[model samples]
Target: MNKLIKKKIKMKKLFSLLWLLCVCLTMYAQATKLTVDCQNPGWLSNKITYGDQMTVKDLTVTGYINDTDIKFLCALIRDRALSGGRLNLENTHIVGSISILDDCMSNGWNCLNGDGHLASLYLPKSLKKISSAIGNISVDSLYFSPQKIHAVSSESFYGGDNKKYLKHLFLGENIDSIPKYSFIDCENLTSIHLGKKMHYIGEAAFYASTNLKHLNWNEFTSSLDYIGPKAFLNTQWKPDTILIGDKIENFDVSSFKYKDGCHVFLGKKVQQISNASQWWSSGIQNIFLHSKSIVPPHISIRYDELHYFTAYIPHGSLNAYKSDDHWGKMNLIEDITHVDSIRIFPTNIVLGHLGETASLSAKVYPEDASIKEVEWMSTKNDVCIITSKGTITATGYGECSVIAKSKDGGLQAICRVAVKESRPLTAITLDIHSLQLEKGEQRQLKAILTPENPDDSNVIWSRSNDNIEVSNTGIVKAKNEGKVWVYAKSTDGAIGDSCKVEVITHVKGLHIEPASLTFKKLGDSFKLRAVLDPANATDTTITWSCATTDVCNVLEDGTVTAVGEGLAVILAYSNDGHYPSTCIVKVDTSTDINIQTIDYPKETQIYNIEGKQLTKLQKGVNIVRIRKGQVRKVIIR
Candidate 1:
C-alpha cells in the first residue's frame, strides 16, 4: 500500500510540471501579439504571470481601460520600453480622473526600473483631467490631442531626472497653460508645441532644457495673457524670434530673465510690454508692434535702456508710440507704411517640359524698409515642391499654387503652378493660314497641337494689333478695315503659325473727273481721274473703254485719246462697284477752223456731243453755230 501511494504521488508531480510548461508557453504566445477584448480578457492573466518582469511584445486592449488596467499595462510597457514601440490609445477610451503612472506604482511597478521609458504614450481623447501622481515615464516623442483634457499636474511630464528620452512634445489646442517645472532638465528635448489656446506659463515651466530650441510662442492663434516668474530661467535656449500672434497681455518681472537675443513680435492684441526685461539685459534687438488701434499698449521700457533696442509700429501709430505714456521712451521708432505690403512675381506658370524648374521672388514695398525676408509654400506637395527661398520643382502632373509670404506676417502672393508630363508640345498648326472677311465679320480659327497627344493640348488665341479682336475660342472679329495677324499660342509658351486676316471694305460708288471731254482732232488725248465715293474703299481698279472704237480710245488711267474724228463716248467702270461713269468726246476734223477766235451771231447756237446748248465756248472741241442749215465743228483750245 505504501509503494502504490509513492507511485501515485510521483505521477501527480509529473502532471503538475507538464501543466506549468503549457501555461508558460501560452503566456509567451500572448505576449508576442495579443488582442484582449472584454469578451476574452486574457491580458489580466498575463499581468499575474510576469508582473514587473513581464516583457509584453504587444498588447491591444479595446473598449475601455481604467486604473486597474493601467496597472497591468505597466508590465506591458516593459516590452515596449525595451523594443521601442508606441502605446497608442487611439479609439481606445480611457477613464478620466485617474493617474496612470500612480496606478502602476500602486500595483508594484516602478517607472525608474528603466522599463518606463517608451517610444510614445498617446493619451486618449476622453482624458479630461490628468495627473502624473509622482511617476516618471519618458518617450522619444509624444502627441496629445486635447479633446476634454484641461487639467494637468506639475508632475505630468516631469520625471525629476529619470526621463532623459523625450525629444519632441505637441500639446493640443485646449491646454491653457503649462505647469511649473513641466519641462525641466529635458536634456535632449528640441521642440515643444504648446498649442494655440494657451494663455499662461507657470514659473520655471521650461527651466534648463538646454537643447530646446523651438518653442511655439510664435503661433498666431496664441491668446497668451501671462507668463510666470523666471519661466525660462537657467535655460540654454536663445531664440532669434518670439512672435505672439494674438492677445498676450502680460509678462512677469523675471519671466524670461535667462532668455536672450530674441526679437519680440507682439500681435495686434498686445496689451503691454514689460520694461522688467524679456531680452535686452541679454540685449534686445528689434520689437515689432502690429496694433492698428490708436490707443497703444502700455509699454514699460526703461528710459535708460531706450537706446538698446528699436521698435516698429503701424504707420500712423508712431506719434502714439513716441509719447512717454506709450512706447515714446523707445530710442528709435519706425513708422511702417512701406513694409506693410508685398507682391509676388510671375504667377500662373506652367512647367511643361521634363525636369522643369522656376525661380520665384517677392518684393516688399518701399526699397529701404528693413525686415525683407520671404517664405515659400506649395499647396500640393505631391504635384510640386518649393524651397524656403522660393525655388520650385515640378514632381507630378497637376495644378497647385506656390505661395510666397512676407516674414512680417499678413501680406502674401500666390503663383499658380501647373505641372505637366515630360511629353512636350512639339509644334502647333492653325486650320487656316489666311482669312478674308468683310468689315464687321467674324470667323472661328482652329489650332491643332502636335505630337498629337501632347502633355498640354490647350491653345490660346491672340491678335497682334487692334485691327482685329480674338476670343478665347479663337473667334476672330474684324474691328477695322485692315489686316491683322492672329496667333495660336500653346500652354508651353511655344509659338505656332499665325492666321493673317485681311478685312476688306467694298466700293460704294465710282465717279470720273470732267463731266465731258471733247477732243478737237485725231491723235488728241486727255488724262482723267476716277474716284470712289468713300475714300477708304478697298478696290480702286477701274476699266476704261470706248463706245465707238474708230472714234476714240480710252486707257486704264481714264485717258481719252481720239483715234478717228467722230462723235464717241469714253466709259470708266469700277470692278467692285459694278457701275460705269461716261465722258463725251467729239473727235472732229476741224483743224481748219480756229475755235479760239470763233464767234457766233446773236441768233446762232452752239451744242455739245450730248446735244446740250452751250452759251460760252469751252476749251475742248465744240460745234459752232449753224446758220441757214449749215453745221460747223470747231476745236477749242
Candidate 2:
C-alpha cells in the first residue's frame, strides 16, 4: 500500500512540468506587436498602458522622436518586464544624443523599477554620439549607425563596462569616423557591420578588443580616407577578404589584423606598402595591386628562392615587376593595360663640349600608352654617361650608344652619341669692366669665351693685390677701401679678362686667400694672406693660430708649416671684431705630384677640391683616388 502511494506522487510531479512548458509556448504565440509613428503627440501614451509592457514583445518606433516621446515608453516599461524581443527606433530625425535610460529614471525614479533585459535594441539611424544612459541600458545587442552622424563622442560603444550584455552591433549608411579608442577593451563585443560611409578609423580605435571578431565591412568602402596606427590591433579579426579604397595612400603598421589566406585589393593609387615582410601581410597568400605605375611600387617582403605569394598587377607591367628589387620575389601576373612598342625621337645625338649634356626624348606607339617610364643606359660609360632620365653626359672625346628601354615591355631604342674635343680658347671677356661694392658685399663676375662651346669650361680666378679676394668660380668679395683688379684667366692659355672692384664702405669683414693646401713632405710651408675690408680701416693687422699644433703650426706672420701627417686648420683673427678667416691644410705621408702621361685603371675615381666626386677630370685641382686607402692630388695649370 505504501509503494503504490509513492508511485502516484512521482506521476503527479511529472504532469506539472509538462503543463509549465505549454504555458511558455502559448504566451509567445499570443504576444502583442506594436508599430506607431513617434511624430504623433501620444504615440506611445495612447497605445501602451503601464501594465502592457510585458505583453508588447515587438515595438517599432518610426518617424522623428524627441526626449518626451522616449519618456512615455519608459513610463510603461517601469511597471513591467520583457523576454528576448526587439525595440527599434528607426531614425530619430528630430534630434541626436537622446538617452533611453535617462528618461525612464528621470524625476528620481529608481532604475531598479524598470523592465527586465531586452534581447535586441537599435537606438537610431540618424542619432549620433551614443549617450551613457542609452549605451548602458540592459540589452543583449546594441545596433546603431547614423546617416547624419559626423562627430565622435567619448560616450559611444566604449562608454563603460556596464555594456557587458551588448553583443552584436551593426552600422549602416553615412557614418563619418570611428575615433581613437572608441571601442577599446570591449571583450564582450562579438561582431560588427561596418557601413559604406565611414571616412577613417582613428589610432587604436578597436585596440585590445580580444573577443571582438568577424567584422562585416561593406563590399567597397567608397568614402574611406585613412586607417590610423594600431586601429584594429589585438582584435580577433579573421575576415575572408579586405577591400581598401583609393583615398588612402598610406597604411600605418598594426592598423589591421587578419589571419592567413585573406584576399586584399589595393586601389590603383597606392604607392607604398610597409611591413609587408611582417606576419601581418606575410600570411596573406594573394594580393591584387592595381597601381598604374610602370615601375613597380617598392614592397617590403621576405625574399627566398621560393615566392611567398602571388601578385596580380596591371598588364604590360609583368616585365617591370618581374625584375623589381622587391616585387620580383613574389609570383607576378598581369591584369589589363599594356604598352606595345617604343621609338626614339632622333637616331643619333652629338655633343660638342666635354661638359655638354643632351636629352633623348621618345614616344610610345600609342599616344595614350600608360606605361611610359623608360630607363637610359650607355654601352661605353667611358665615352659618355647617361642619367636615368635619358640626359647624356659627354665624359671623353669618343663615341658611345645610349639605349632607352621601356620598363613595361622591355622594348629598346638606341641613339649614338659623339663627343669631340673642344676648339682652342682664343680670348676671354668679362661681363663688367668696373664695379663698386660695399665693404662686406660680394659679386659674381662672368667670363665669356671666344668659342662658346668649349670642351673644358674652366677659368681660374685671381686678384691683383690684397685689396680684395676672388674665388675659382669668379666670385669677388671687397676687402680694402682701395681698388682691386679681379681677373678671369682660362686654364688653356694666358687669354683672360679683368674687372676693377672698388669698396665704398667702412670695414665690415675679412677675406682669406689660398683657401686650401695639400702638403707633400714634412716642413712644407706657405704664407696665408688675411685682408681686412676697406683698406682705410684703422687696424688692418691680424693674428694667426693653429687648431692642430701637433700636425702643423702657424707663425704670427700668417705662415703655415706642416710638421706631421694629418689635417690642420689655420685661422687669422681680425684686429677689430676678432673674426677669423680659415684655411685648411692636409699633409700626406708620401705623395708624388710630378706624374705625367700615365695610364689609369678603370677602377680609378676622381674628385674636386670641393669634395664633389667627378666622372672625368676638370681644370684646377683634382684628387685622383685608386681606392679609399690610396689617393693622389694632381694640379692642372
Give per-model TM-scores.
0.41, 0.41
lDDT of 1 by residue, 1-637 (tens): 9999999999999999999999888766544444555322224444334532345544455655555566556655655323455566544554434334321222122222335656766665555444442255567777676576653433454445544666878788777777776766767778777877787777677776777777766672366776666676555555566655555566443455334334566666666656544442554444433444456776576656545455666555567667745356554455555477888889788898546788988898766445677788999988889888788888888899988887775578899999876667888888999988777889989888788778677887888899888998899988888888998898656567798999888788877788687776678889988888777778788998886989888887887888887788778888885878878888766666554566668877878767788997676767766778777775664
Q: 53 in model 1: Cα distance from truth in Å?
A: 11
Going through the candidates in the order shown, the clash numbers are: 3, 5
Q: What is the alpha-carbon lDDT of model 2 when measured against the actual structure? A: 0.69
In model 2, which range of ten residues has the least summed lDDT?
A: 102-111
Best by TM-score: 1
Most accurate candidate by lDDT: 2
Across 1-637, the per-residue lDDT of candidate 2 in tens digits comes to: 9999999999999999899988878766554677767565435566555435567777777775545566655544444454456777764443323343322222222122234456777666655334553433566676765555664433554335655555677766566678887777767777766676778788777777778877766543667878776777677886666777778777553577766655666755566666521435535545443455566766644465225456777657788888888787777777544568888868797778888988888766565465678888899998899887778888898888888888778888889889887577888899999988777789889999889876556888888898888888888888777888988888855788899888765457887788898888889898988878766665677988887988899898888888998888888888766777889999985533444555678889889999999877666688989955698887654
